[model samples]
Target: MPEPDPNVRLSNAEREALIARLQTATEEGRLDLHEFAERSREVYEARTYADVERLLTDLPAEDRALAVPRAPAASGDMVLEPSYTHLKRQGAWIVPGLIRVNPKYSRVTLDFRTAEFTTREVEIAVNLEYAGLKVILPKGAHAIDDGVILEGGQVINRAFTPGGGQRIRLTGRVLYSRLKVRYERRFLWWRW
Candidate 1:
């Protein structure tokens, strides 16, 4: 077979497959959590096949096969809904342009420390009912709370810093729930 084109853009399915492969590697003791997280972030942020292939250079051939080539989508949106259990998305996950979170009687946390943002601006639309939603952003990131229609609930924003870097706009409604947005401070031992 011919070598895959390095400059070819990746599709969502291809990226997800790579992520699953990495997770498998971690489960098989081939990679640790830190290494898997780092590689996973790289996979999501990768634009071309070459960018993704480099991440699997040290992995086994079976794992590398998951990084197949596919067409890229015009736009990407991620949706999350937790019914009873808590859901947390952290590490090196991909952060699309639009994110919709709807949780009922559960908790959802989104950490954007090692996340890859394809666009300069991100929009988060939340429809929470009797649940808790927390968003953690990196320092220097800007966020705007457009507005929220509440029915016996509160929206506490501690990450709204209008400066530079990337921008995140939050909008939606909360009914008998809590939405907290905070920033992650850089520590001495933490390396981004």
Candidate 2:
């Protein structure tokens, strides 16, 4: 693989624009977070303007200009499969089986109690962060907001996940009771 370009990196504004476009793909369930991140990182480290332009020149053209770059069904393109697993309902609490998050996929899930006539399953996305995450802690407790602060200006704030990749080993914590941290990616669709 080509080494990332540090000298010709994207500006914050340009990076934000690219991310915004990627968000469109994510919202539409077109590009899973992990894939989005991989593509994003590649784009971010683009060395030449031509490379960046070509990279984004093929974004899906459809109703929403914000649509994520569809996997070019060119045979070599990878297919996206479902990433949800079963949710364990242990009395009042709920939990997922296992999840994985990477530069190609990230997801989020909400855990809650369910009433009769319903069973819920979900996978909370944590890695491959596009948007931030929001966390609500119980009463009389507190926690910090940074997940893993790296040295290369890369911050893996588990608190700001959009939720729904699969590989999950990271998360954010909100210190204190009744605390709601406004993260970027809040997976509201996750439930029990």
lDDT of every model, 2 decimals: 0.80, 0.37
Q: Which stretches of candidate 2 lie over 4 Å from their true place?
A: 1-9, 61-192
Which segments of model 1 are wrong by more than 4 Å?
A: 1-74, 185-192
Residue lDDT tens for model 1, 1-192 = 466777878766677668767877876899987898799789878888888787888987867844344433426788787677677888756778999999989999999977878889999999999999988888788788876778899888887768687798888899999988888756798852
- Cα lDDT of model 2 by residue, 47-121, tens digit: 554555554545664422223232211222111122342112122222333323322222233223221111122
Worst 10 residues of 2 by lDDT: 72-81
Model 1: per-residue Cα lDDT at residue 159: 77
Q: How much is the lDDT of residue 81 in candidate 2?
A: 25
Per-model TM-score, in order, reads 0.63, 0.29
C-alpha-based local distance difference test score of model 1: 0.80
The predictions' CA RMSDs to the true structure, in order, are: 7.6, 17.4
